[model samples]
Target chain A: MNALLRNKLRAFLTMLGIIIGVASVIAMLGIGQGSKLSIQQQIAGMGLNLVTVVPGSQQRGGVQFGASTMQSLKETDVAAILSDCPAVLAASPEVRGNGQAVFGALNWPTSLYGENESYLQIRERSVTNGRMFTDRELSSAAKVCLMGQTVVKNLFGEGADPVGQVIRFKKIPFLVIGVLDSKGLNTFGQDQDDLILAPYTTVQKRVLAITWVQSIYTSAVDSKSTADAATQIEETVRRQHKIKASDQDDFTIRNQTELLSTFSSVSNILTILLGAIAGISLLVGGIGIMNIMYVSVTERTREIGLRMAIGGKGFDILLQFLTESILLSITGGIIGILLGIAASKIIGSTMGWPIVVLPSSEILSFAVCTVIGVFFGWYPARKAASLDPIDALRYE
Target chain B: MKKLIEIIKLKKDYYVGEVTVHALRGVDMVVNEGEFVAIMGASGSGKSTMLNIIGCLDKPTEGEYILDGISISSLSKNDLSGLRNQKLGFVFQTYNLLPRTNALDNVELPLLYNKTVKTKERIERAKSALESVGLSDRMHHKPNQLSGGQQQRVAIARSLVNDPVVILADEATGNLDTRTSYEIMALFQELNNKGKTIVFVTHEPDIARCATRNIIFKDGVILRESEVKDRINALEMLASIPLEAD
Candidate 1:
């Protein structure tokens, strides 16, 4: 320890590799974990235990038509799923269209979604201002609708209350009854608050003039029962369509759990890759320790001889050198940990990345450094210990 | 008188690839307690090898060496180190005090190897040892801060700190000037008068004359041995040399 303190600059330089290595390890892992958590939060924001059934691709005379064009999912399928699937809590039939919404002289292009009253609950949305449309409004194919924040901002200007105001979508007049809470942008960079919601019967009768829904959105009783609810909905839908056992289903089910797991696995692989790259740097740091220790032993040959001459033993000399290296590495480790955490915090704020510094990573890096210290310090210390006292004394 | 060092039929062989160089052919000698002896020889005359054997730093190829009644030839490496710590002190030609360390700490080094000496006692002993070598004033000065003679004094103090059976000096004044050499010799004579056993090694006759007895080595054997009939007092010699103010 005293030996290391004697040449403070050299000691610090030798520890540079370790500091950088540990700091990088910590920073990389933090970013990996942070991004992973952010992804999860964004996905969860879409809604929990939510499942969607979209119409599969269809073929007529061996000519293929792409997905969501089959017109196989009807309003009855949503009702059948809710009644037959015990795991389902709520279900809504959906019809989607894109049109320009006009208010007074202002107009904005946006999406319009047609759904029943249960649509808000299944999508985990709420009416922040006015009330949602009642079932009577759905039965009558009422044109009353709810506006999202983006639509409200574009058509009616910011902070303007759109409820009870009239807007025209595709030249058809509709009365706005409520404004949905803001959800910002989702993981795919799509604006969740840029659409308007109205009764599915209105879009089916007046907009597309089709009897079939584009898709069905359903919520499960709990997150754990989502898969079971998906399976039950598939069976119920198949039975309603009276599809044969040998034939392929005309609808496909997608759930949040599958999406969540896929994202989690990808992020986990990314974390490991980053950690492995950082570990290589740590290995380089260990080699640096070994190199310095060897140089130190060679430079202090006379000192070792003098100590031995004055009654110091081989074991004592070994311990002295080993202790110095260990002290160097551990000091570097501590400083690196501090620098890493600071770097993580800075990145988190400056880059807007969610940074989570896991305690396990810090402990893992600390323990690894100590092991590196011992492993790299051993050979040089042993070389010093095994030197011949007479030859060492005579060494220039 | 008690025998502090005993050597009988001591022979040392060194292998230089194909040839075995005989460093010490059969040699027999003994020094009693409180006697100052000088081992004299030219380069490669086996005097350094004898000193190394006496210092317990090396094991002889074939010999019987007993220091203060303990047989050194039968001891293990660890036991030899313990023996060196307990019963031996060494002073070198270059005054090999650790650089950047103060005189007190340099002197305290030998006692550091001795587990029985506590820190408080170690410090006290080191202080007294430095005082005995007349380096009490320079106790806190580093080796680089002191002159060559003062550095030698610190080395002597370190040798005395452990209260060993004998002090073995290999050209202790080899690197010093005439005035400083005599000054160090004078300190050695003073320690001798206080009944400390010392074995001084040198090639200079004048330096050898400071000791009570001398043994000359030639071609790996002792050529002659004699007691100093007219022992020169280093203090008187220092007085004879006219002082030049620095």
Candidate 2:
């Protein structure tokens, strides 16, 4: 221990690369873990209480295009399904189109969505200002619009309350009823917090002048009943569309739980890719340690021989070299861990991502450093051990 | 007294670029319980090779060497190390003490090899050996911290720590000046008088004259033998030799 400490510079030089390598693995892994966790939390915060279904078949030259031939779903179907499906706690149909809305002097072009009173319940959305449209307003096709927080901020200026004010959609007057809570940006980089919502009846009759609805959402009593409720709704919709089991349906039924699974699979693949990349860095560091150890053995050949001649055996020489290598690797591992943590923290704070340092990574990196020490330092130790005492003593 | 070391027809061979170099020709020799014998040879006479073989650092290619009744050829490496530790001591002209180690630690090394010697006993023995060599005041000094003569004394003290019967000194004064060389030779003579067997090698006639007996080697063979006069004690010889101020 005393002799080893005396050669501090040599030891430090040997460990330098290892420390950098380990630190890189740790920091990168931490950032990855943190980001994965944050994304999962963000998805969770979007609320799995809602489910959506979109059209998938074909319609000739209509707004439904070549995908769905018959647009079997409408506002009436949503009403019938809501009344027939007792498993469904609530349901709403949404219709979307490009439209220009003018409020006072500002004229903004945005995607306009039309929904019913149950839209907030089915979508798990909250109102930030004013109130949700009443059932009477939706049933009567009343001209009331719920603006997204982004729409309000962009068009109505900061701290502006546009509620109860009148706005025109394609020159038809509509009253601003409420504003949606901010949902930030999602994985596809789309702003969920930007867009406008109005009654489905109003959109079909007053805005788009179309009879077909685009999509529908339903909220179940709990997460466990989501699959059952989707099945029940799908059956009821198929009966209403008069489609047989052998033929493909016009619309698709989706559950939010399946989406959760899809997200996990993609993230898992990404995490593995990241881990492998970091592992390559560790391997590079291991090679660096090996190269330096070989040089050390060559430089200290005379000392090795001298030791053996006096009384040291082959094992003693092996131990000395082994100790030096391990010393280097362990010290480097410690430094790398610290650096990795600091880097992760910086990434987490700056990028608004979660940076979690998992325990397995710490253990894995330390073990990797040790294995690097043994594997790379072996050749030099063997070289030192096999040298003849007489020749070694003669070495300058 | 009893015979402590015996060498019979010992021949050590080496291969240098496909050419055979004979380091030791077939030779028979013995050193009794208490004797100081000097080996005199010119360069390439194989005196160092002979010393190395005697010191158990190497084994002869063919021949039997019996040290304290154990055949060196039959002993395993670890056993040979044990034999070297228990039976033989060595002194070199270069004062080959480990550079970073203090005098006390240098002397304590041989005792470390012997498990029977406890740490306390090793320390006491090392201190006594230093006192015997008149370097007790410099026990804590490393080799680089001491003068050439003082370093040689520490080496001498190291050789005596294990209390081996036979002490091998290969050109024990080859690296020092005349005055320092005589001072070392006087120390060897004193250890020899205290019933320790000395086997030293020297090329200079004056250095060879200090031993009680001298065996000359030439062409891998003994060419001459001289009976040295042992009438004077070591301190008297040390005093007679001229000295320069340190």
Candidate 3:
């Protein structure tokens, strides 16, 4: 240890490159993992337990095909899907548009949504205040509304409770029954706590003045039977729309499992890409170790010769030198781990991502640096050990 | 009498690419315990080659070389190194101290390689060796910090650390001034009187005259060996040796 510390300048220069390289690897991996976790959460919150049914275009030998518009789904279609899809836990039909929302001199243009009470349950969203509409309210098509937390906050001040307050939407007055719990933002940059929810019947008859609904959502009991629920929903919707048996139906069902799998695949690829970039820096660092080790061997050649003269075997010289290199790299690896963790936190805080530093990966980086030191340091040390002592002593 | 080292018809050869150069030609000699012998030679003489072979730092081409009654010719490199570390010590013209290590640690280095000595014992023994050579006050001083005579004393201390059977010096005072050279010579005589055998090299007649006997070499063979009486005292010799004012 004293001998190792004696060559302080050489040790520090050798460890510097390794530290920077490992720190980069850690920071890049940390940030990348943070984003993956965050995105997964947002996707999971969207009732990844649910499946979405949209329209699939009919392909003819893969030519002259355009997207098939799914406009036939409506309140009745949603009801039939709920009843027939036994695997489904709940279901809802929703129509979305944009309109001016007013609450006594505070008016703002917001994304308008008309969805059934079950929409909140199917999507795993809940209200922080008030309650979902009653069964009578669903059948009677009440004019009451449920606003997202953001909409409420925008119309009212931060401290105000929006429940029981009457807000006007495009010249129609409706009392707010609930303010939604904040769901933050989704992967597509859309705020989940921004739109308003009301009865589908009212939205269909009044707001958009359209006859057909936009999309159908059916959630499974849990994660287990999402694909089965989606299949059942597709079958029910196709039959309720009264499409001909010979004609190709337009709607397609996409399960949360498939979407999640796709997301994870992309994220894994992204993680690897970022990791490889970091690994390249480590490779350069390994080369730097090789370079410095060669220089060290040259500088210590005479000393190596002296040790040999005094009873140090070739392998003894090799072991001592190799141990020195490994010690240098491991020390660098430890410092790099600390620096990388700190840098990752700084970046995460700045970008608003929840970065997590994994200890196992840090250990992995340290191990890799150790291997790098030994592997790259072997040749130069071997050369030093093989030098004839006679020539070495006679060397200037 | 116990023979510390013996050589019989030891021949050493060197090959440079396709050409061969014979460095030793069947040389035979024996060195006993506590014998201070000087081997004197000119350029291209085999005295240095003889020194290397006797020192166990090189293998003889074709000869039976026995050290401490064990045949060294057939010993593996590792075995030879072990023998050298346990039984022999060296002092070179350059003083050959590791650049960064201080005096005490340089003395400690051989003990470190042995590993049989406990850590505390190793340090204590090293300090004792330094103290024996009168370098205890300079124990922490690096080689570069010491003058020529002090550096040689540190090297002598390093040589004595393992209590080696023989202390070999190669042109030991070649790099020093006359005053320093005699001072180093006095230290060697002191160590020799303490029961350590000493073998050193020199071309100077005056330096050779200071030893118990001198073996003169010419063209790779010992031409003449002579014993001397009334050996000069180091300090008195330095005082008498003539002229420079600094």
How much lDDT does candidate 1 score? 0.92
TM-score of each: 0.84, 0.76, 0.81
Over the full model, what C-alpha lDDT does candidate 2 score relative to the true structure? 0.80
Model 2: residue A384 alpha-carbon error in angstroms: 1.3
Error of 1 at A184 (Å): 5.4
**Model 1 residue A25 CA deviation in Å:** 2.2
How many backbone clashes does every candidate have? 0, 9, 0
Encode model 1's per-residue lDDT on A1-396: one tens digit a residue. 668878889999989989988998999999989888887877766866888999988989988798777989988898899889999999999999999999999999998899998887888888899989998999999999899999999998899998889999999999999999999988679999999899999988988788999999999998789999989999999999999999999989999997888988999999999999998998899899999999999998999998887777889999998898888788888888889899999999999899988999999999988988999999999999998889999999
Give me the runs in candidate 1 sitting further than 4 Å from their true place: A48-144, A157-160, A168-177, A181-191, A198-253
The residue-by-residue lDDT of candidate 3 on B109-129, one tens digit each, is 888779798999999999999
Interface Cα RMSD in Å, per prediction: 1.0, 2.3, 1.1
Q: Write the per-residue lDDT of candidate 2 for residues B139-208, one digit (tens) a residue.
A: 9998899999898899888889989878888777888877788788888888888888999888988778
Q: What is the C-alpha lDDT of each candidate?
A: 0.92, 0.80, 0.82
DockQ of each: 0.59, 0.29, 0.55
Off by over 4 Å in 2: A1-4, A25-51, A55-146, A163-178, A183-191, A197-251, A254-292, A344-362, B104-140, B160-165, B182-197, B205-213, B224-227, B242-246
- lDDT by residue (tens digit), candidate 3, A156-175: 97868988989888787778
Clashing pairs in 2: A34-A354, A34-A355, A57-A67, A57-A68, A58-A67, A58-A68, A58-A69, A59-A68, A59-A69
Worst 10 residues of 2 chain A by lDDT: A62-71
Off by over 4 Å in 3: A1-4, A52-143, A149-162, A165-174, A181-253, A351-354, B235-246
Give fnat, all candidates.
Answer: 0.58, 0.16, 0.58
